[model samples]
Target: MSTEFHKLLFEISEALVTDELAALKFLSLDHVPRRKLEAIHEPKAFLEVLQEKDMIGAGNLFFLKELLYRIHRIDLLTAHLGSSREEMERELQVLGRAQVSAYRQLLYGIAEDLTSEDVRSVKFLLQKQLPKTKLQENASMLQVFLEMEINGIIKEDNLTMLKDILQRFRADIKKKIDAYEEKKKENYSREEVRYPVSVSVYPEEQGAEGEAAKQHGKIYKMKNNPHGYCLILNNHIFRNPRYNREGTLQDGEAVKRVFKWLQFETVEYMDLEGKKIYETIKEYSKKDHRNMDCFVCFIFSHGEKDKIKGVDDECVNIDDLVSCFTGTNCPSLAGKPKVFIIQACQGSVRHPSVAVESDCSGPLEVDASPLTSIPDKADILIGMATVEDYLSYRSRRTGSVYIQSLCEKMELLCPQREDLAAILTEVNNEVAKRELEGSKQMPKITSTLLKKLIFEVPQ
Candidate 1:
């Protein structure tokens, strides 16, 4: 490694705490032996072992970047690695690119998502399986998982104990494990079926040209490794507890999952201030997208007519956010697709984050508030959660109905390369069918897109 690169690793190593090192070890178990990882006491030693095994280096830093991303250390990525969360996410989509196993990532993600109380519950469930020392209060979830693996309780192919425990409190996280297992089984079945494999003389050339040229003749080009930045501005908490958008984080997660699957560099900014939202949007607009295809943004927060409210209760006009991507303002993305999905209420009748409807039997859901329109900029599309005078619904447990429903539709339809309009149309229909507070929410899709904006994901 170069001296500079060595210095970078040194800095990163110094930054990692003990718990993060445990996470790094657990995630890297597939590559590094269990016995080897257990002996590694510090970040520097662990990284050195990785370097010795050629898992990370100056030429191949993907694994290194992934480790930081796995531990939710985007600051290290930006400051030291000269990369961002968006950049790493885009890179992660490349075929066979990820060093960490999906099973391991899923476990680590669940561990991070769990609260202290949740961890205690998990430990209580595992008390009989592991020793007293391993299930202590001071023991982190990652450490508990290590104990499970050591005791032959859960493995790469067997996560029943973990799944059963998680399903009690976090069905969503448990569902992830189930999905992974299902996909694994599917892959096995496909391999056993013996599908035909065509071998072209110039496979690389044809594959590249075929993907780039097959955009239905007259549509926006969507042939980049990363289609574009899928920026998510989710404000879940405010200074005042009353204004907290409880389920907004779930919306951000849903958007990030779908867009990243579509091969976009998904970057999420949480609980941004009124001024910060504008700054973040403008910052992305200022980025050079010469190598990108389209830009997608999801702003899920509270707001009023033609405006969005930041965590600090500051208001930013919908037009101002859209203007940042105007042809003149953002020249690089001039003719490219710019999509903005807003999840908030629009009318003066502000919807409480959680509400107990008097007419209804239960206090089932809360709501987010907004209505928005783009400027006269061609190729810009805005999908508002609700129409000009209605409240949008959000779940304290799940997420906003608009965004979650949209992401579900995108995942279902995008495999066939569905256009943005078709996807949003499906979203509108799906969300419209639901009755919140015994009323309906009609999502508005304002489009100036001259050509169809289809997203072609990584193979």
Candidate 2:
């Protein structure tokens, strides 16, 4: 047997606390005597003897397998030894639901500054964060998170929400400490006065390329200005690192440039994990964008049927991404265009193989949920790279099929007074005509536009 296999055998023995002779008797092997198994001191040798005597059968293996399975540790079995750590990762992904992950990070962040004596306070904070019933159910999970924080992995990149929560907690803690210190001081200096920082940058209007548009019995210039903000969230690296996206930065650059040319102040956030994506949107939503005209957000990341993976490998629902900016939540951008362009596979399903002379075509079924039922809010547009339940192709050399075509079409058509819907339609047609890895792709756009939004280019 290979060295890893031998090592696995020894590890399994260490995991099983039953006596060697008792374990052999439990196996109920007819050929292997309890005394002969007792002569073997090492687990590897015992396993070898079982194989040599041809005593390794399904029934005999169950004795060991059942013990491991009972503890939910079957992954430590010899056949799965090498991938045991991966099993933990998969479990964490499933366990880290969106709300749970967010709260987990928050708790982890607060726990970092806590001392051994602060355990009671930490537990109290955990209870305060959730209701009593929910806290009871998550008690064990919270213990695991506390262990992860002590190990130094909880504060890493994937748990930004936690870190951000920690930051807020730290600030409050510092304030309390400072207040206490002030009371103890007899002669303390007055707090320094700080003035607010200001900016001189103002919105510049790009003169209309042609005639003005008539609105409310008035002729308004068809000029575009930096009326609002454009957020570009591009996630490439992930906790597993295997799913790290290449050529995504190029796609983000294309989006930033196009949005900048359209006079929107483009802000780019790179390599966010699942919770941070929501947190970032929520943070941005809190900002007053009443002075701005429209809002646009672009996401380039790996996706599933109806969700996108954060760098931490957690999946977040796509509707939650848009709903963060809905008029109800973010009233500053209300009644203005809120556009989202997502470039991720809608599902795992691939294109069907076709015969040259075949006249019958089969309908494609996506195994994932439909990317629909976005809240019935006006002025929201969602642009998906592919139709429901299909993969969106990206090249290691160039960028994604959808983004490249979308940018090219936008640059070509935006100056011509084409509405965003019309421009995206052209993009869909352009992407559909191209084939990647022998599969065709068509983009999907769902919109509730109250009016036509055009990025009027300067002459």
Candidate 3:
């Protein structure tokens, strides 16, 4: 082995044998040469102690051995100093399988009141050395090297090796981020402004007008906007597995029930005769190009992550529907906000009964296909019924848990709030608290909003 490699190994082994923390500090700061040690008032205190013990040798091995002995005494003095055992263990776990473990073991063994910041500083030292060690190893050496490699450290023959590795890593990450932005630009190049919104209501399934009336009041209050036009799409087809399929209500009847309760400037009941849901969204997206500031797509159907079933029993990919409004096709709304509110199950079943007392009730389901591709420049906000792998509820009595809370918040909260992000944060907190009460399903929102959205409807 080369003298440099041998010296490095001896220093590491001696440090490991000594107080690991001191060893880590020494190695991390490049051995802190003897001249630098003179700055301290007790410069030769450690060396004099070692000499009294009659242990002295020339070169690396002798000095390393004496240093290790001094470190051992220091370790004895500092033990019994930090927090509880559990907190120490958690910090160690975060450090993972690295050279830092040896130092942590020594530190925790001595201290009873060690602060988290202290532990982090020690870990940071080990993290810095990982890359330098990785680059110097041969293939055989590399295989046996046990130290975890720190990201962005590389071995090189040139003097500027460390600087080169850092620059390379930064450039690589930047390239990936830039590509993402370019794709977003290509997707929304049409118009610079657009407006889109989705409105959905599940009217009384049967003789439940009283419950529907309360929900209608909430929806009515939700619809009173001071800006932006509203396009409401109502789902009227009812198919109960318990009853004969042929006896279910027709489209006209379902539409009439919906119209009896809510009002909008342009309200259209989904024509579930034989057409696909994607086709319907595509048709509507093209209408009235004059009022494009944002885009809203509301879905009220049985859905899984990426798929939602239509009223006519056809399943559609949620991505297929969302693609129609991409920046590439709908330029008017490019870089504007695009919102999707889905009321569906991403999974198959609801949670079984629990003993805890609660008022919120719903199935634990996840939408199988939610938004797969999100635009970076354009603002996209997705509000789902539950977290991934849980059921969302649609009660025979109450409509949807998310919709109810959303409408209530819009009326009671939005009227008073100016910042949409703050409003949504409140909505997240409210839904989380309420849904956990009666059901296991909790509402969630994933957003990459580019600009602030204010829902004031134009008079």
Candidate 4:
């Protein structure tokens, strides 16, 4: 909004040529969506788009400086941004400062180093993967890389195909790929949450804490940067229109925000079928979770007594779902805490409210589902929205009573190092006092965890 800032951007935009503009756009492909970048032709227009995206503005021009530095525009950097090459280098070196992903930077760097002939050679090699229409003669290396990403030929996690193509003709460039992968692996390992895996109780663990930790006898290790994955399976629309679950999206959003704030790699799978839901769980179970400290799952859908119905109106047995993470099935998570939060009606009946004061009063809907009776597995905790054969309450405007309360309680108590069992007890107490449709909802927590599960608060 500053007039001086707009004048500075306008002057810088005047200095950039077409190719330099293309290069700037390529370098910024990670931060801005591809579809958005495709519409801009002039440098000033691109700068305006970046401004709209909050990528550049007054007192927030680091990304613009990075773009200029990458484009070898030191004159513009010095004159307009009042920054030098050395200053940008030092700032970028700080951990988590760069907005662009390292993976995208690698691809752009490779494209810049390649000649037109080299790009044609690369496109010829990718003939089998992408359609011929996308690999036309006028296609640039950046475009070819975009095609590879869109076609699943390459990704941040998997770059084998790109390396293979580069190694065939450009062995020198292939070496860069090797170095990048090695450095990435080192960084990932260093970033993982590290803690002792042994479950044996230590005196120091028990002696330092107050009544909360003493009550549980021992504490679960959650020393990793991201304790573990918090997978949310939200079924909003069912194949049978009448079974559509309203307000479940709110539940997923609430949990996602809380878990991400708690430093967990929160992922959500929306509107999955029964079979897909099982497969999703199995897929996660197969992943190597050695670097993680704990695993949490949230399932929001319709259900019967001991079964949850997917969007396809097909039911999955609650027992079978939990079985996917037994010690034998997911060895890496054996000693780590595994938590499941269920939001569904257990039965058709409603629990009678015998309260002195009514706390929960609002428009209510039901998620028409489990916990408890899990197999003999240690380090697993299950939180159910309601007791067996009882209906739980959810609001169309807000989320389900149990999940919202649980997220709030975690945000409040986890910072104080309160164990999860104690946190869920607080959720139980909170939800039990509320009256939804004149009926009380009591959340249930069934845990085989032998130790107190406490999350470390970020400083």
Candidate 5:
């Protein structure tokens, strides 16, 4: 065997003996797949199977399985690994006249029940099967088993992979400890510095015309005065009346009104045809890195979960756009919040509005693709207009029900409450009560905020 393979074998053996049981118990709790567990039997056997099938190493197959189990629990494991009575009989027949012991049967039963069992129960079972001596003696082989089990547990947790959780957890703990130590070492004499915040508003279609419409309406107005450095990317090309294809003229009108109510500094009305939006965001994120506290992108366009459509009918993945502001590229906003407000549809799942006397508003349609990936460390707040599969309504006279309600709530609730989440909750409640009445779609708010954010200018 090659050095890397040999190292793998050694690691696997160690995992099996020392930490395999603990890891397996965790996996069982998460509901890892049987196939994944089976692969951990022996590296030689695994290699042989691969060789026979003309395959390579397990790749990410085992890792993925473990990851699923961790997020979902043991129910998934039973569903994937449980064998029918007929299949069991076939296996017995293949084994010839040899009778299977009760212990062996119990072991199989436990394996099958791995998904249903709790972490403690799994640990007990694993301990019964592999004693400490066996684990310690064959530590290398055990490592592989442990790795497989760990993967399964993480899977049940609904994560991308086991390695990610492990790495993140370790990093987070270390960071916390470091922060604590640093705090302790520092003197309390220096005055704290208050970070300055910048807000940018991007109105699509209607240019200054949209801004004019907002002034006419009875709506909550955002202050036009620029607080700090801000860049607004507006789609001026769509402002023309000729672009109204549906004949409803609703979108164009809404854009115009929203622009009127909106406030920002240095507005750039560029055609978001190709990858202009992504490139623009990238360039802006890089500019004035030292003074910038964070980055915000408010996109008002027709969109799905992964993509947003431009005026000239171009598609851009939200991930590609957001990646530009990550810690690796834009270190200024590393620990700071990166807020992205998306006023679009996620998917096609709509929920009926319930008739209730209570003040709380029911959920609207579930957005098709809810945010799947938002880094734990980075603060990312995503506010969607309507739930999945439902149309976000816009009146000829008034603006979108959700947006109108949001602005109203921001004006009223933000001053009293400093927390952004609390403000959003009020917005949700208001939108639900006002916009969701007799309507099918409900507005939604999703966030991965690292710390409490004060929306109103902090006193």
Candidate 6:
């Protein structure tokens, strides 16, 4: 390795050694098996051991890069590891393709091994057939395959094969469920059942009333103008020398304009550290929302999977940010729609392009808030720029693909009295049509609401 690269690695190793808990998590995530971690104090020694033991595999490099980001040493990653977005993704692609092939084989093996005994019961099958414990082992490529399979996004043949195996398991579970219910002389509710056999299927909304229920609440109709506060935590600029998110100001301006047009009082935070971001939200959450009809928050920043970065490079989980305004945490906002528009990359994985084309807080008062919260059960809509573990594009010239399309869609649709979900669906469609260097982008929305959210001009 080059001298400069060696120096960077040494610093990282030293940092890890000093942070025992973080080191343990890192080791566990990457499966770096050693009797103890204390002996690896220097980078050179660490590299040697990893190589000798075959612990530093290609699959684990993805997590290692994320580890660098989590610890705020991305500068070291770029300087020494040649991990520019393109370079790193190229490496990941090679490893990803290989892993996919291996996982296909693994799936075949599992299919062959699935005997009648394996599907004896749902509980037993989940614990036995799927290797559930090992699935929690690391953020590996195999997990991606499992998610794709579960979501029915894999190839039809493969999906059919996987489903064939699962069908046996499901059938056996249903038999068991039937027997137990017969014994009790009653049918059990779906919610009351504890079986992994249930496959979630969302029914299509029928008619305006059904669509309206999914969009926003009946309270929206009682008010002429939307009453709520919109907070824009925009981090266009960064303290990290390696990062510069140009055109992000446009994202902030566009969101501010839209929410303001929606008649919601809006506040924008230009650049904040992670703690300050937490503090701002906490303070905002404490405010009474008795008169407000809804809440909107837009977070624009650099991010990794499940977390966005503050100007100072500290990472904050997106879940933590949204939970600050959950019903239990901010009771004043209960029964109201809380919308979060997040503009950030969710992971390091890059979509393979077949062709061509275009495209908080406050350090002064650290937000000692916990990194996670009990996810609110209802009335929360998280609009992520991209699906988890994928990149969301941004132009040095024009803002992000997702936010720009979102604002444009809202601008056009809001005037027509269309609901938020409809507009977001249009945004997703518009973004799906766009490509950057042959790579596609897709926005995702996770909503739990009982009413339609339509922002109409005040009479």
TM-score, every prediction:
0.50, 0.50, 0.42, 0.52, 0.43, 0.49
Which has the greatest lDDT? 4
The segments of candidate 3 whose C-alpha lies over 4 angstroms from its true place after superposition are: 1-229, 236-266, 271-275, 353-369, 375-377, 435-438, 457-459
For each candidate, the alpha-carbon lDDT, in order, equals 0.79, 0.61, 0.43, 0.80, 0.44, 0.61
Which sections of candidate 1 miss by over 4 Å? 1-215, 350-375
The C-alpha RMSD in Å for every predicted model, in order, reads 24.2, 19.8, 24.9, 14.0, 19.1, 18.4
TM-score of 1: 0.50
> On residues 78-139, what C-alpha lDDT tens digit does candidate 4 reach at each position?
98888999999997785545656688788888998998888888988888889999989987
Candidate 2 Cα misplacement greater than 4 A, ranges: 1-212, 215-225, 351-368
Candidates sorted by lDDT, descending order? 4, 1, 2, 6, 5, 3
Give the backbone clash total of model 2. 5
Candidate 2 per-residue lDDT, tens place, 40-138, comes to 765556667765653333223422343243234545643544334444445335311111123233343344445554444444555644445533433
* Candidate 4: pairs in clash: 193-224, 303-368, 344-369, 345-369
**Rank by TM-score (best first):** 4, 1, 2, 6, 5, 3
Residue-wise C-alpha lDDT for candidate 6, range 1-459, written one tens digit per residue: 356545655665665544433332333332344344345654556555653433333323444454454344666567655565555446445412122122243343343344534534322434444456533434233343444455555542434434444566555533433443354343234323322221222144356535444433242442524478899999877886447677788888888888787798989998899888877876787676766778888888877767788888888877767776765456567767888888877766665543321111211222232223324457888888887666777776677788889988888887666878888999998888876777888888888865677776654
Question: Which candidate achieves the best TM-score against the true structure?
Answer: 4
Model 4 accuracy (lDDT, Cα): 0.80
Clashes of each: 6, 5, 58, 4, 49, 15
Identify the runs in model 6 with alpha carbons over 4 angstroms from their true place.
1-226, 351-376
Q: 138-199 in candidate 3: lDDT tens per residue?
A: 31211111232223232211213322332343344334334544644654553222222212
Q: Between which residue pairs do clashes occur in model 2? A: 105-162, 227-292, 227-293, 273-311, 274-310
lDDT by residue (tens digit), candidate 5, 165-218: 223434443343344335434522221212212112225415553543333222
CA lDDT, candidate 2, residue 321: 76
